[model samples]
Target: MKISPLRSVRVTRYVTPLREGGSLPAIVEADDGFLYVQKFRGAGQGPKALIAELIGGELARFLGLRIPEIVFSDLDPALSRLEPDEEIQDLLRASGGLNLGVHYLSGSSTFDPVVNDVDALTASRVVWLDCLITNVDRTARNTNLLIWNRELWLIDHGASLYFHHSWENWEEQSVRPFAQVKDHVLLPYASRLEEVDAEYRALLTPEVFRELADLVPDEWLDDPASQRDVYAKFLTSRLAHSSVFVNAALYARNALV
Candidate 1:
């Protein structure tokens, strides 16, 4: 488990607020370049949210999905000069401090909530991955997805599986049905059921599983027995239904790719 050192960043000026995440995320210019700085919030879920941003984002990258660059840093609260409405400022302070940027969504904010212009085929691929990873987010309301510059980008994985680990149990770990895969904004361009199944089977290699487990932060894996048990249960459960979800995705995208 290697931790990357936080780089020293200098903010030139702040860009307008994006949206109010549990914490208010902002766009800021750093000495090196532009990056999203998410100030830490002090709520009960803040730590969990940060963990999801780090671990889940990295795992998605490992599984060959398109994700944004992410890192951890502390904002020198003094540098931020945003004058939010009094209520908003109080909420901001309650959140922790000034920060900028989060998972980046390229281009304008238009293709929000989910990816657009995708057919069933493409939707299958997205659904298969989401199902396997137990991504409970990406629903219609808070879809947590975006498309920019004609490429799909996933954001706000904080609501995914591992974030709520404490409340999870082995018995509750099962693949949810992908009946709505095709209509899912992020999964509209799905592959046919057959192809999606094959791809899912091919991608869930034991090595990939092990590596993904390894990326879990030491704090989460802090206890060897607990970590091993959790990973073992997670992998076994996910692998058990890989074919079903994968096939569903492929079936959706039968005509294309």
Candidate 2:
């Protein structure tokens, strides 16, 4: 259950924006001489998006899934001075503090289910994780998966854990069935939902939930530590209601049977 703490890096140079989404994620070079897909804390989605990315990415690693390395990236406010684009400059100015960095995958291709084949177990686990976290963004149109070195890797988890948007009554919604699971891109390939439930469920212990939740930076959250406790409680509740999500996924995939 033990894992290394997230590494921190300073952005050395500004790169092109991905521009595919509203958050305006960018490809940047860091002090470590590595490229990172930077999620700005100043983006319209706010720090909560980065928080979701950290929590979801770490939890995936704990479950032995292939996720890009996440880091607490430092963005220098003065870097904005070099950007001529007013839009990006504003972004840099707003996000002059801590941002989220996803290790850039070089020579990777977007995963298109139409032409690619994914094994059942891998597909099932991915689908189950999405459902468990109430991540509704991994649909056919936006798989949020990449094929790097001929291996499937998950990315863009900023939309998961939607309940965190409203800390008010978040606990009550934690146990609710993750309905968007029906539209999951992998559901058709995930034929072993029940098996996935039995095997993967236990891996996410209460301790793991708390541990992963604690990974979020204190500054990003309004009440800092209180948010971590809330996240832990919500995740632990979701784990306890694992069956509800598992069954819902199975029922949604029943069309294949």
lDDT of each: 0.55, 0.89
Choose the strongest candidate by lDDT: 2
Candidate 2 residue runs with Cα over 4 Å from true position: none
Off by over 4 Å in 1: 1-16, 20-22, 37-44, 76-103, 112-115, 119-121, 162-165, 175-183, 186-191, 216-236, 244-257
Q: For all the candidates, what are their Cα RMSDs to the real structure?
A: 5.3, 1.0
Q: Give the per-residue Cα lDDT of candidate 1 at 67.
A: 65
Residues 73-172 of candidate 2 have per-residue lDDT tens digits of 9999899999899999999999988999999999999999998789999999999899888888898899999999999999988999888787778877
TM-score, cand. 2 vs. native: 0.98
lDDT at 49, model 2: 94
Using TM-score as the measure, the top candidate is 2
Candidate 2: residue 33 Cα off by (Å)? 0.3
